[model samples]
Target: MKKQQGLSVIAILLVLALVGAGLMLVFKIVPVYTEYGDVKNALTALSAETNVGEQTLRQEFDGKANVSGVTSVKGENLMVVAGAGSNYLRAKYQREVPLFGNVSLLFHFDTQAGQPPAQ
Candidate 1:
């Protein structure tokens, strides 16, 4: 009998299963990261806005989050720090995406923006 030169049926099925799982993970994860990017941008924009107080900044951030569909961090949870006559904004949050059944992926994001004091 001629020797087999290609993958067996079982081997092919296993490879296909792995590839499918990888694609599924990618599909589930990319959107979460995209949302994180939007959150970062929102924080940075709020930091740069002139003449906005802490409460106003929190409100604006909430508005931005609503518009961007970011559900991880609410305006009430944002950390506002006062330093050297300036305000700083920090956002620390986490997102969870289900992979399969009870399995899930957790992602944490921390972002901060503000001016630094002179050296």
Candidate 2:
């Protein structure tokens, strides 16, 4: 009986551990996907904005939006940039790990090309 009880406890603990990991991935990784999804929708709006090709499109727009977990904090610039002579849009972003260790989500939008980046 004692051995059975111990095994049961261990099994329960294992299950809990698995659940915790799932939650962490859900909470952490899901947001990244969610933010990216929003950015994806935004990209649909940007197809006409590109004077170059899809390579440039992906380079300049797709996977290039500067996004984080929360708002009101400074983050890296992950914008897709267009270069000269077949230079297409490319993903570009700045990586800024919080010094204070506070994670923030920020989204940067470059509304106009060949102009100053806004937000």
Candidate 3:
């Protein structure tokens, strides 16, 4: 009897299916992270600037979000933390992405200015 070579048909199909699923997940999650980056940048920019009132911060964040095309977290979602010298902007939100029939993925994002992004 001849020895089996490389990957069999079943193995190849299984590998392909796994790869496809991984690709789909990446494709679905990448955009959310991209938007999160935008949100972080906006908050950092706002924080670096002069300290302002909470309402002003919200308005500023809204403008920045609009310009940066960040739709995941809006200005209203931001929480302004007033400090003595500078202000901190915190954004906490959740995103639900439907993968396949009745299956969904949930992502929780918590980002703050002058700090690192949270998962």
Candidate 4:
């Protein structure tokens, strides 16, 4: 009987620990990873428009690294350009404290000068 009770108690404690760890990871690491991915995507998109369109993107967070880049490359079959512009560029990069910080970026977004957002 005591052995069974002890086993049950151990199981409960293990479950609680797992939950706590999950919460911490969720609040910390996720946001930063997300922000990084977003930056990559936005830059890629901005590079697509070339000299013709105004791209608007948001900075994910306001911090020391709140920076965005734009570049263009020409290939035999495809031309690639990506990055946001001054008038239309915007984004919010957020680093959640613990776990969620790794993936806090809610989304990666970029827009051309004329088209509207998808519904």
Q: Which structure among the candidates has the greatest TM-score?
A: 1
lDDT of each residue in 52-110, candidate 2, tens digit only = 65455654442344442432212223344443432212223322223224864444433
Per-model TM values vs. the true structure: 0.85, 0.41, 0.82, 0.37
The global C-alpha lDDT for each of the candidates, from Candidate 1 onward, is: 0.83, 0.44, 0.84, 0.39
| TM-score pick, better of 2 and 3 | 3
C-alpha-based local distance difference test score of model 1: 0.83
Candidate 3 residue lDDT tens string, 17-75: 99999999999999889889989888888887665777888898999889878877888
- Report the CA-based lDDT of candidate 2 relative to the real structure: 0.44
Tell me the tens digit of each residue's lDDT in model 4 across 14-79: 999999988876765555565556454554454444344331222221211344322111111122
Clashes of 3: 0
Output the worst ten-in-a-row residue range by lDDT, candidate 2: 88-97
Model 1: how far residue 64 lies from native, Å: 1.3
Q: lDDT of model 3 at residue 92?
A: 92
| Candidate 4 local Cα displacement, residue 33, angstroms | 1.9
For model 1 the local lDDT of residue 28 reads 94
